[model samples]
Target: MTREVSRTRLNMLRSYAAHDHRDNFQKAEMV
Candidate 1:
């Protein structure tokens, strides 16, 4: 159970990081 929770958390973090990276790239392009 603990391992599954941690895995979900890691996936969330990875997705968040990807989203952030895309936002930064778009902002840079706009500039």
Candidate 2:
């Protein structure tokens, strides 16, 4: 159960990281 929770949290973190990276790319492109 703990492992499953950790996995879910890790996935959420990865998604946020990806979103931030994409945002950064977009800002760079805009500039």
Candidate 3:
């Protein structure tokens, strides 16, 4: 159960990172 929870958190982190990366790219492009 603990492993499952951690895995879910890892996936969430990955998605958040992806979103941050996309946002950063767009901001850089605009500048």
lDDT of 2 by residue, 1-31 (tens): 9999999999999999999999999999999
Name the 10 consecutive residues with the lowest summed lDDT in model 1.
1-10
C-alpha positional error of residue 7 in candidate 3 after TM-score superposition, expressed in Å: 0.3
Report the poorest 10 consecutive residues by lDDT, candidate 3. 1-10
Per-residue accuracy of model 3 over 1-31 as CA lDDT, tens digit each:
9999999999999999999999999999999
lDDT of 3 at 12: 100
* Per-residue lDDT of candidate 1, residues 1-30 (tens digit): 999999999999999999999999999999
Candidate 3 runs further than 4 Å off: none
In angstroms, the error of model 2 at 19 is: 0.3
Which 10 consecutive positions of candidate 2 have the poorest summed lDDT?
1-10
Models 1 onward score TM values of 0.95, 0.93, 0.95
